[model samples]
Target: MATYTINVNGKKREVDADPDTPLLWVLRDHLGLVGTKYGCGVASCGACTIHLDGSAVRSCSVPVGAIENQKITSIEGLSEKGDHPVQLAWKEHDVPQCGYCQAGQIMSASALLKKNANPTDDEIMGAMAGNICRCGTYNRINAAIKTAVKNS
Candidate 1:
């Protein structure tokens, strides 16, 4: 095992893990940050999405050792009080159904908004295409993103 220091949620965190271990496991198993869920062990699913250096990434596919010095932001760190505009919009629009994919969806939306404050419908769909909601809440998700844009 190798030791690595990573910046997660603006905090410096140290963990000892194998070089091939995915960042998802490090955050959930090692750091006890379970907001980033594990849907597919591969990178196909966005369930393990997190922000790495201001870009949304799939933590399930990102190796811990390769993420040193990068800033990681999970759903828990998005807002201390859970009042981020996107989160608020999420609540206002009632976007969640099963709630399994909401965290990743929120993370992806927040990242997209960070880059583009006023994204068009196409842009919103394109940015959130990677995340899948089994409950098929696409319409609500799209509405929530629009609300977040207006609210923010």
Candidate 2:
């Protein structure tokens, strides 16, 4: 085991874990940040999405030791009061069904908007295609992303 210092939600956090531990476990277990969910253990699903150094990343596929000095932003840290534009849009559009995938959905949408504030329909779909919602809320998710774009 080894210790790695990482910046999470604008705060410095240190964790001692195996070098190969996925950032998902580190965030949820080590740092007590469980907003980042565990969907597929592999990187196929985007349920473990997070922002690593301002870029959307699959935390489940990112090794803890490889993320030292990077800034990590989980769903809990997406906004001060869960009021980020994407979050507001999600709520306004009623995007969650089981709510298990909403956190990753929001994180991905937020990242998409960060890069393309005025993304077209194709862009929105392409950006969010990787994050699957088993409840089949694709239309609502798309609408919410567009709403977030408008609201922002």
Candidate 3:
């Protein structure tokens, strides 16, 4: 087993496991941070998306060792009281259908808003393309993003 030191949700965390273990497992199984879900083991599904150094990344394919010293932010870290603009907008727009992919969707949306405070509809779609919402809440997701942008 290898020991890895990483910064998660603004706190230093250390875990002992195989270096090649996917970060999603480490975050959920080891660290008890179940906010990041596992839909597909591969990177095709964005259910495991998280922020690595403020960039959206698929945690399912990310090795535990790869994020050493990197700032990792999960859905839980998005806001202190779950009152981030994106979260609020999501609530106001009722974006979640099944709610399985909302965490990843929110992560990607937050990243996009961080980069482009005023993103066009096309830009929102492009940034969120990788994240799949099986509940088919795309319309509400887009509206939530736009609402978040307006409030931000």
Candidate 4:
């Protein structure tokens, strides 16, 4: 087993496991941070989205050892009281259908908002293009993002 030190959700963590282990498993299994879900292990679904060094990344495709010393932030770290503007907007706009994909969707939206506080509809769609919501909440998601931008 290889040892890797990673910063997750603003805390330092030391884990011993195979280097090839996906960061998703490491976070869910070792660290007990289960906010990042496992949808498509192949990185196609964006369900395991997380911020790796401030960029949204598919945790399922990231090797644990590859992110040594890199800052990682999961949905849990998005807000202490689950009140980040995006989260609030999500609630305000009622963006979830089944809610399985909301976490990843929120992560992706948060990343986009970080870069562009006031994104156009096309920009919002572009930023969230990779994340697939099986519940077909795309319209609501876009509205929520716009609401977040306006509220922010």
Candidate 5:
């Protein structure tokens, strides 16, 4: 194992792990940042999503070593009080059934809004396609994105 330092949620964090250890494991195991959930253990599911350099990334597929010195943002760092517009919109819309995928879903939506303040429905769907909500709350997810935009 090697020691690597990375910027997470604006703070410098150091972890000792194997170079191939996925960012998801590093965040959960080493950093104790469990908000970024583990699912599928691959890049297909968005459950391990996090912001890498301001863009949504699948932490499960990213190695901690590859991200050294890069900025990382987990769900916990999205806002100090969990009051980000997208978060508020998620709550306002009551968007989650099992709630396991919401963090990644929110992260993706937040990233999308950061790029396009007023994204079209197609854009929203296209951006969120990678995130899978087993509860099938796609309609609510879409509504929350629009609400988050309006509330922005």
Candidate 6:
């Protein structure tokens, strides 16, 4: 085991873990930030999506040792009061059915918006392509993205 300090949610967090430990486990198991969930355990599912240096990434496949000193933002850090524009838009659109993939969805959407304050529909679709919603709420997700853009 080795000690590594990483910046998460704008705070420096220290954890002792193996080099190859997935960042998902480091956040959920070591740091007790369970907001980032484990879905497929592979990078295919976006349930473990989080922001690494302002870009959305699948945490399940990212080793903790690889991200030292980088800024990591999980769902919990998206907003202080759970009222981020995307989150509010999500609620407004009622996007989640199962809600298992919503966090990742939100993270991906937020990252897209951050990079492009006004993304076209095609752009939005491209950005969210990697995230899969089992409940198949793509329409609502798209609506929420548009709403978030308007609110932003």
Tens-place lDDT per residue, model 3, 119-142, is: 998999899999998989999999
Over 4 Å off, model 5: none
In candidate 5, what are the lDDT values of residues 11-61, reduced to their tens digit? 998889999999999999999999999889869989999999899999999
Q: Would you estimate the TM-scores of all the predictions?
A: 0.98, 0.98, 0.98, 0.97, 0.98, 0.98
- The per-prediction tally of clashing pairs is 0, 0, 0, 0, 0, 0
lDDT by residue for model 6 (1-152), tens: 99999999999999999999999999999999998989999899799999999999999999998996789999999999999999999999999898999999999999999999999999999999999999999999999999999999
lDDT of 2 by residue, 94-149 (tens): 98999998888889999989989999989988888899999999999998888888
- lDDT against true structure, model 5: 0.94
Which candidate's lDDT is highest?
A: 6
lDDT of 1 at 48: 92
Residue 116 in candidate 4 has what lDDT?
90
Once superposed on the true structure, which residue ranges of model 6 sit more than 4 Å away at CA? none
For residue 39, model 5's alpha carbon misses the true position, in angstroms, by 1.0
- Scanning candidate 3 in windows of ten residues, the lowest lDDT window is 61-70
Model 1 spans with C-alpha error above 4 angstroms: none
Deviation (Å) of 28 in candidate 6: 0.3
**Candidate 6 global CA lDDT score:** 0.96
Q: For model 1, how does the per-residue alpha-carbon lDDT over 1-152 read when each residue is reduced to its tens digit?
A: 99998899989988999989999999999999999999998877699999998899999999987886889999999999999999999999999999998999999999999999999999999999999999999999999999999999
Model 4 residue 98 distance off true place after TM-score fit, in angstroms = 1.4
Candidate 2 clashing pairs, residues 3+ apart or interchain: none
